[model samples]
Target: MHEVFTSAMLAASVAAAPAQLSSIDELAGTWTLVAADLIKTDGSVVRDYGNAPKGLLVIDSGGRYSLQIFKAERVHFASADKGAGTDAEFRSAVLGSSTHCGQMRLDGGQLHFHIEGASFPNWEGTVQKRNFEFTGEQLRYLVPARSDGTVPVSVWRRLAGQAARP
Candidate 1:
């Protein structure tokens, strides 16, 4: 489900906006997940996504954003019903997917995500701060280390349109 920021909400946020991101106007478009990696504190890497990860991140002019990421290859549950998945299926679904939507603020080198909702209940109503960098068409960020002592870094590339371009 996509939640949109109405005109009033957008006006209110812009009224007190201290962190202006005019420099990152190039990021006002749809971006597709290009790469994702989790680095453990032990200096090991977990690559459960094989070679491809599927996801989308959309950023609008109002600072509202939505992100969804998932493993490209997930096993199907035995039951076709959405709520009747087996334990293993449920586990896989939870472990291999993430979804969050809310407003975001970019201040200098720091990025803040004011999460309105998330697939991980613990993250709902929380603010996540991260260091971010944008190079060419790719936007990258280093998330704060997780409770498991792993840091997940994600890269997103702008999705080009079919028409016009060199």
Candidate 2:
């Protein structure tokens, strides 16, 4: 009877304990892109950045971060001059990459990016909130739904030996 009571008490105490909290400091490091996908409302997945995307994300302990993602299969501009690209080439170039830098903070299990500037000029000076989770070395985040109702999701793996310096 005593053993039974002790076991019951232990289970009750464990049930009353809160889940372990996650800290923003755990995100401070250099991460490489694993995948960039878009999820449709009907449950179909689209690889918007091609089958193998390329990207980098760097987060500092000081709350600053820079993120860049690019399509690995972008078409090369035929012209040697950077400013001499055709309209289609320019559009392809713009559509193939995204980059932004800003201050980031975690609140209520969400990450808020206060954009100082971005390749997409409309995002400059705006705050974007993302729902994110960490699994082992990978960090995954869901982008808010767009007007078309597709949600973008990005997965990044923390680079080994790239911990943030004090």
For each of the candidates, give the backbone clash count.
Answer: 0, 0
Candidate 1 per-residue C-alpha lDDT over 1-166 given as tens digits, one digit per residue, 9 for 90 to 100: 1123333332333333343234444456788887666666655545534458788998876668999989867778989897999888988888889899998887655678899999999999999986665654666666677787777767678787721111
lDDT of 2 by residue, 1-166 (tens): 0011222332333234332226567788889998777777765667868878899998887679999999878888999998999898888889999899999888766778899989999999999987766654766677778899887777788898765332
Error of 2 at 82 (Å): 0.9
Name the 10 consecutive residues with the lowest summed lDDT in model 2.
1-10
Q: For model 2, which pairs clash?
A: none
RMSD of each: 10.8, 11.3
How does each model score on TM-score? 0.78, 0.83
Regions more than 4 Å wrong, model 1: 1-25, 162-166
lDDT by candidate, in order shown: 0.69, 0.75
